[model samples]
Target: MAHAESVRVVFVDAETEEEFARTELAPGQLPDSFEYETRLDLGGESWAVVRADPPSAAQFLRSGSLVLTLRRIQTVDPQEMAYSLPTIFDPLPPTEDSTGSGEHFVIHEDDWRQAELVSRQLAGQVEAEMRAIHEVFRQSSRVVGEGASSMRVFDRIHVRRTPIDPLSTEVSLRRLSELLPVGGRPYAGVRIGDDPGRVVDSFVIAADPLVVYGQALGDRVTVLCLAPLLDAATESAAGLEQAMREFDLVLADWCSGRLLDASAVGAFLNQA
Candidate 1:
């Protein structure tokens, strides 16, 4: 594939600083198109989330600081036929900001920089531990949350098939199947406990390499490379910085189209 259709950086924490986030972060600074306030409460256990969508980018700031996700949707015209535009999932409920001036969410050439800055800023205001960082690629059939607990974070690659205009279900399935081998239940998916270098692992959640049934309108088979976080015991500034650096290595390999069976996936994505 040429590059990701869209990339998102997500920050996870152990605490829910709903009031503090709402009160301190300004909402007015964001673009008016993002709307003044949107409230969303998924009910028990789920953190209350809020969303702000500007022309250049989109943001998800949740209650209790469960997570904060920043995404930049890449644009591809209909003629391109590679990927869909983008989908913006709703954020948590709105908070009460004393300043009422929301933070300015901008997409830079380097997303890592923005991610690091957000992690640092959030850590300064709250006592929550920086649990994990997630990088999401959307509208991408070839690639792919949160918590402060002592769980190992996996850097994953997701490959899926989504319906774009003019491509019917039958046609989409046929087109995608041509790229990889289709198989029965036994060979439907494969998982390599240890990666090529024994540095990571790989898993195929669904076997759509050639063909399969029960595929949703927007989701087909997906293969993921789960990169484990080895040195994330600390949640301080130093810890976060180290994690970010390690993540960069994983992201770089994925982006370069060099992971397990990446060549096969890339060939599929390159098709018109």
Candidate 2:
């Protein structure tokens, strides 16, 4: 929890939910304990609003049972706060480091054994997703040009995957390589050919959260910003993977600009 108190909204059904809100009675802070469970219909066939002090719940009844969630207000230290915000300076260093030769996390044999088992499962998923992404580009039309010229800097580089052409892959690859993050990583993968240096980070199966920054050299690095959805993968890794593909197709395309010419948006419906 944050040093400053926060409230969590929750939903409960058919039972009185009890939570512990602190008894300190600070006007804007969270209580140590709380209890707010009652039947107040939210007026839908499946939803209800249950209020309990600072803790509120809105839930839905699915197939005759209430789906309940206790939203938690979490806290982060100063470092996480800084990193999350866009800054003009270099990111702060790691506050803590672990050699792991110490007390916690181990008993070694058990840990490694558990990891090895999970690795086997995830390995298959990684290969399958990569193959699918590659195949989509292989079958689709080649997307041309650097995204938006104004958004890129001389030092910034971009890597793109698009359809392979029968006569000239080199010309397209040359144009695409112009936008990669310079000196950050090499361009490493392409869908259509045996081009060298195609996989930028062969192991960068997912994007790191883009820290919006102005580099020391007076150039800008505008990243595609897929890092947030990448983290979302921990809860549902499959969702993370699917989102990455969809983002490339949807959000990313629109980021280039607009797909339709509009007068007031409705104007385009009767376009010639």
Best by lDDT: 1
lDDT of 2 by residue, 1-272 (tens): 22323223335432445442222223243323235433322333333333333332211111111223333333467442311111011121112232223222111111111100011223333244335434434442233347573222111111222211111111122221232222222212211122222212111122222111100111211122121222232222333333323222111121122222112112211120
TM-score of each: 0.16, 0.15
What are the Cα lDDT values of the candidates? 0.24, 0.24
Candidate 1 whole-model C-alpha lDDT, 0 to 1? 0.24
- Model 2 earns a TM-score of 0.15
User: Candidate 1 residues 213-248, lDDT tens each?
Assistant: 211233322111222222222222222233233222
Task: Please provide the root mean square deviation of candidate 2 (C-alpha atoms, Å).
Answer: 22.3
In model 2, the worst 10-residue window by lDDT is: 109-118
Please identify model 1 stretches exceeding 4 Å from their true place: 1-171, 186-272
* Predicted structure 1, TM vs. truth: 0.16
